[model samples]
Target chain A: MQFFIEVLLGGLLSGVMYSFVALGFVLIYKASGVFNFAQGAMVFAAALSFVGFQNLGLSFPLALLAAFTTMVALGILTERVVLRPLVNQPPITLFMATIGLSYVIEGLAQGFWGANVRGLELGVDDVPVQWLMDSTGIGVSSFDLFGAGVAAVLVALLALFFQYTRIGRALRAVADDHQAALSIGIPLQTIWRIVWAVAGFVALVAGLIWGARNGVSFSLTFTALKALPVLILGGFTSIPGAIVGGLIIGSTEKLAEVYLGEYVGGGIDSWFPYMMALTFLLIRPEGLFGEKHIDRV
Target chain B: MKNVIPLKKTLAAAVFSVAALSAAVGDAFAQAKEQFIGLPSYRVGAYAAGGSGLYGGWIDYMAMINERDGGVGGVKLTWEECETEYNNARGVECYERLKKKGSTGNSVFQPVSTGITYSLLDKVVADKIPMVTIGYGRTDAADGRVFPWVFPMITTYWSQATTMVKYIGAKEGGIDKLKGKKIVYLYHDSAFGKEGLTVLEKQAQKYGFSLVLLPVAHPGNEQQSQWLRIRQEKPDWVILWGWGVMNPTALKAAAKTGYPREKMVGVWWAGAEEDTVPAGDAAKGFTAAGFSVAGPNYPVIKAIQDNVYKKNKGNMEDKTRVGSVNYNRGVVHGIITVEAIRTAQAKFGKKPLSGDEMRWGFEHLDIDAKRLKDLGAEGFMPNLKITCADHEGSGLVKYQQWDGKQWKIVSDWIEPDREMVRGMIEESAAKYAKEKGITPRDCAKEG
Candidate 1:
């Protein structure tokens, strides 16, 4: 029973971390109709910048601010250079452009910060929380709990921002209809830059947490690949759906790998989540929380 | 009309200079005064930490030789590194791209990955080039009769695995103490990671120990469940056959599960500084099966420092990594390669030797302690001597423990059970030869 509880807690915490990255994809896709494939690259770039700045002798807060600013600038540049030019292209073209942008960003990140792995010290201790362990006999990593707390706070803040802010309204308008939003006076390009900037901020947070978990390296970009299944399950256009989908995928994969992976060759964690997402897709093509689109010729 | 004579004279002079330049260029090309070594390096990927140190040390040692002695026997050594990014396909592409370079073609090809080695085995054999996989590649390739072109020069994975079990036996007071012990093999889920399973299973059968197999997926980061299982099962000892991010992550998971880190031992590839440094202090007292010590105290390292770094010709961007574990492994690779070239030059004429000549040198290569002392690398590595029947001579391994900061040698050199390992190698080699329909060369018939 204690082992079961521990695995469940660990799975939930890991799910929250996945949700953090999935939220970045959800934020961009919600505002602009194009899927942002470069979210992982942005996470890698942000983490690299943070580590690089910290190595430059800056305080943690200052280094984080500098990294966040760099990500914002990157988001603005990406909007102006890549997305703005391909405004009215097909969604597939935009998706491909984002993929190309991911390569460019990855190259630029590694070019600026050499390709060596650097440890990111986020001050979150990875040791198990003593109180929780003593009380429930289930050891939960404090770092994981801290990461979950941060993710929860960020999600709440994003929810409030989308509900009350004027720019958030414009972002919604742009998501609803780009031409209609432009016709009204809500600048579609400006909304895109804002959405990208927000997504960049989310990437920064995701990068810091993931980097804190695993050392900052090029492999951090692979977290973006993990987020694809989350996006598929949660619906790319739904923020809450991303969070829920991430938790579901994360917990299910961990539970499945622990309970069932041994009967198979024991590496089911790699493909189990994707298989679950594929199964889910068969039932609902629009995803769990995605809006249904009716198309007529 | 008066100036026509001078103009014609100027034209003749220009033509003469062009002809002279072309002749000089042709002579330089024909001389073939340089030997080209192909380096399939990875500088950007999950395994970049290992790659940087390995390639950096290799380039530094070669540069040091050039700076100190102006090349081996007046023949300059040139090398071109193609980045493989630790991917098998890219590694093969790198091999193909670099094989055609240099004056007399590529002297040797070392792909540095078991998967890449497997992919390029037939290619290198067909191309008639020597492929040197120092401590990695097919374990059966140690039998040089079948794998004529492939050299697993240092130690095979089978030897390493058996040696690890031997070390465990020693720790438990005797080999008989291993009976009924639950030993877990926590390994990466790839060809390289799974290379030691057969050996471990055979050892288990012989020694009466239970073996548990746990495979970590590629770029292994999430392992909460795996470690939890280890915690529950409480294996007597865990042998980690992992690389790259998997090493540190495994250590972290061990710490999280409150498992004793000292009970776990990593393979040679998982013993580098990057493997443990990321885990911070939790990696203290972590043991690993190591072939070489990590430090700058070796004479060869000092020579490299004096010749390469002092002269600003060293390839490592980070000067501090000159004496790191993986870097030293790279230096050892460079030393063995240079020694092979020297051996070939001694046998053949003193000019640039071809790949076949290099193969001969590898077959007959002998690096005794005296040779190592002359090369300024005494006590840096075990004395190695390759023969026709055995490419991997005396698989010597040692245990190193990480004491929060660096790896320290904790045990004397231990030789793997050669009788058992050789039987397996010959059997596997015969299987490979039959599969390929290639005739095995008799050792007695060879020169």
Candidate 2:
């Protein structure tokens, strides 16, 4: 039972990290209706840029600021160069452009900062929190706890922003129906640029925390693979759903791997989440917080 | 005022320039004493860090030889790089594109990837090209009687596995003291990752150690469940058979779970500076098996530094990586390649050797301790001799440990349990030959 709790908590913590990356995707998909495949590459570029600036002896805050500036520039560039031209095209075409954009972003990141793996120090010690361990005999990393807190704060702020902010509502209006949103004085282009800039901010935060955890490298892009399942389990459009779905997926996969993995030959954690998300998709096509849509004939 | 040339005149000039350029390129490639090595490199992509270091070292070593030795037996070494991005399809495409390059075509092929090695296994045999899989390839290809074309030289995975167990045994006082010890085999879940399982299982059975196998998925950035289970099991030791990001991730996870870094050991693929430096202090005290040692102190490295880098003709942008594990591993590749060509030159009168001729050279290659000293690579790479029946001349591994900054050699060259490894290789090769409807070569018949 003690070991089980530890695994569950660890899984939840891991899921929070997945939610960090997933939040970036939700912002773009919610606003523009285009599933940004380049989110992972953006995360990688952001982190690499942060590290590159730091290597040049910049303080952490400066590096963060520089990296955010780079990401925002990248987001604006994507708006002007990629998405602007593909406006009103099929969603698949938009998706393909993001895929191409992903390669270009990856190339640019590595090109600017040579492809070398570098450790990130966020000054958060990764050791188990002593008080929690002593009280409950369960090991939970303080670094992980810090990461979860950051994700939670970001989620709350984004949730409130979408619920109340004028730009946020306009962004939602654009997502609901690009044509219908355009009929109003929403200005789809301005709304998209704002959402993408916001998405870029999310990507930078995700990259720093994730990069600090798993040394920034080309494989940091692979974290995007985990977000796909999270997006499926949660709604692609739901900020809160990403968190809830991450928790569910994270806890379940770890628990399953711990208890049931030995009998099933182990290493099931990778594919098990995908399978669970597939099952969830079958039951709730619109997802837990995803808005349901119906076209009137 | 500017005057524009006529369309026909401009076209004729462009055509003549292209024709003249082609002629020069054709004449340069048609040289009798030129040896070509088409490098299927991955300078950019998922595994680019390691790729850059490795191909950089390889290209540098070849450059040094040409600069220092005027090429082996007056045969100038030439190469072309084709980016594979570490993808199997691109690797194969690169192989096909470069097979017919140079005067006598490609002398030998080395893909530096297990997936690419597997893809070109049968093709190399059919094409009469000898492929060298220095450390990672078909372990069973060590059985040269059955696999005459493939040389998984120096050390194979099976051998490395047993050598790792031997190193562990030595640490436990002796092999006899390893009875009933619980050893965890934490491996990456890919063909390259799982290559050590069979030998490890065999070692476990023989030594009375409890071997626990845990697999991490590909691009293994996440290993929470696996590490948590590892913490639960409280195994005596953990053997990390990982690659790429998997290495540092494993190190970080172990640190997070309070697993002692000293108790964990990684394979050669996980032993580079790139592997340890990324995990920061978490990688401290972590040990790994290595075929070639790191450090620029070796005379051969100094030679490259003086002859190549000093002259502004070096391949690596960062010259400090001259003695890194991957870089030196690339140098080791260069040594064996040049030696094989030299050995063939001794028998076939120098000049550029064909792929078929290079196969003969590889089969008969020998680099003794004296030869190594003469070449100034005595302690950098192991001295070995290849024969018709033994493709893997030696199965020697040096253990290295990361002490916060860089790797330090922890153990002398440890030889694997070769007799047991050879038996397994023969059995596997025999099965493979039977499956392919091919007859094994008799060692006596080979020249």
Candidate 3:
């Protein structure tokens, strides 16, 4: 029972981090209606920038600010240079453009950083807090508890901003119908730029936390790949769905691996979460919180 | 019209220069003045740090060889690296890409991944290309009588694991003292991690230690909870079988959980400057096993500096980082490879050796103490030999601790317990034979 609890907590902790990345993906998907395959690369880019600034002897707070600002600039630039040219193209073309954009960003990152894993300090003491009544009961790391709290706060703030702000209204207008939005004098281009910038900012925050945990390496981009299933499970348009879906995927994957892995030879933790995500997709085609759409001819 | 004649002459001069360059290159290839070594590296994947260090050191040593001694056997060695990115598919692709460019077959194919090792085992066997897998891959492949194509020198997973448990047992007063003690095995979930478990299990049965198994996924950056459980379980000791970025992170996690760093032991691959650098001083006192010489003061290392780096030919991005554990391992690899080539040359009349001849050389290696001293690798490794029965040239290892700065050797040159090793080898080799549909030679009956 104790082991199960520990595993559950562990998995939920991992899932929370994954949800943060999935949240970024869902935001971009809703705003542009284009699945940004480059989300992973953007996470890596942001993490590298933040870590690079910190390595330059800058204060952590100041480095984080610089990294966030750089992410904002990257957001605006990607929209202007890449998306602006493809404004009238099919949505598929935009998706493919993100793929090409991923390669470009990867190359630029490699050319500049020369591909080495840099260690990141989360600036939190990594000591464990033994909250279990008994000395031998389940415990949690201070780093993880801190990570989960910060993620919750970030998600809540983003939720409020999207619900109450005027820019958020414009974003919702564009999401409802780009043609309808344009008819009502909403500048689609400006809205895209705003959404892109917002997504980039979210990516920056996600990148720093994840990078702090994993250390800033090119491999951090893979965390974004793992977030794909999280987005699918959490309904790409639902904020709450992402968090809950992330926790479920994370916990189940760990539990299955712990109990079922030995029977199958081992290393099942890798593919189990992905399989769970696939199962989730089959059971609910519209996703947990995905909006149901009807089409009549 | 006179100006046109001068212009024509200038054009002719330009064409002549181009022709001359091609002829020079062609002539260079003809005389076999250069030894073309193919370096298939993976500097952009999960195992990038390790692969990069090995490749960087390899190129550096080769440059040292050329710049210091002009060349090996008066032949300049030219190498072009193809990036495999540590993927098995890419590794196979790289082998196909680089196999066509030389006067000779590939001198050495060192694919660090065990999965790649298993993949390339059959093809390289047919090609007779010698594959050097230092401290990795199928442990049963060490039986040269069965699989002569594979060379896993120094130590293997089986030997290392048994030795580590033996060391642990000794610390607890005796092997008999380990009864009922709980040992938690926290490993990266891969063949590399799985390879050590059979031997560990065998030893656990023999020593009466109960094993608690925990596997962390690859690119093992998120191990907070795994350690959290270890804290709860309060296992007597934790053995880490991790690689790449997983090492430092594991150490840092242990430090966070307040686990005594000395109580945790890592495999040889997990114990390097690269692994502990991220954790900094928090990783102090952490112990890990190593195969080769671990210190900075080897004679061959001195020669590498005097001959390779001083001449502007060393790949020493940071010259101060020379003689590091990984750098020394690279030098040791160079020593073993060059010695094998030289051994084959001695038997085959000293021009250049084929892969088959190199295999024979690897099989009959007799690197005694005197020879090691003469080769400038004194104190870097043990005087060892490889036989038809054992591709693992040496079963020697030492425990080293990360001292916040460098890996300081904490134990003497200890050979694996032979009775335990031989028994484990027979059981494992028998299992391998049954799985692969092959028969093991009965040395006793044959003799």
TM-score of each: 0.96, 0.96, 0.89
Tens digit per residue, CA lDDT, model 3, A1-297:
877887788789878888888988888888778888888888888888887788788898998898888888888998999998998689899999999998787667655665556667777766567664258566566777887898899789878878899888888888878889999999988888888888888788787777766566666677776687787788888788889888888888767766676677555667777787788889997689887767886
Q: Report residue B15 deviation for candidate 3 (angstroms).
A: 18
Query: Quick one: how many clashes does candidate 2 have?
Result: 0
Badly placed stretches (over 4 Å) of model 2 are B1-30
Q: lDDT score, residue B430, model 1? A: 95
Across residues B1-447, which tens digit of lDDT does each residue of candidate 2 receive?
Answer: 133557778899999999999998888755777899999999998999999999988888899999998998888999999999999999999999999999888879999889999999999999999999999989899989888889999999999999999999999999988898999999999898889999899999999999999998888888899998899889999999999999999999998989999999999999998899888999999999988999988899989999999999998887777789899988998889888999899889878999999999999988899999998998888878899989999898999999998889999999999889999999999999999987999889779
Candidate 3 CA-lDDT value: 0.78
Off by over 4 Å in 1: B1-31
Ranking by lDDT, best first?
A: 2, 1, 3
lDDT of each: 0.88, 0.91, 0.78
Which residue ranges in model 3 land beyond 4 Å of their true spot? A1-8, A88-93, A130-138, A251-268, B1-30, B280-282, B293-295, B316-320, B423-447
Model 1, docking class: medium
**Candidate 1: TM of chain A?**
0.98
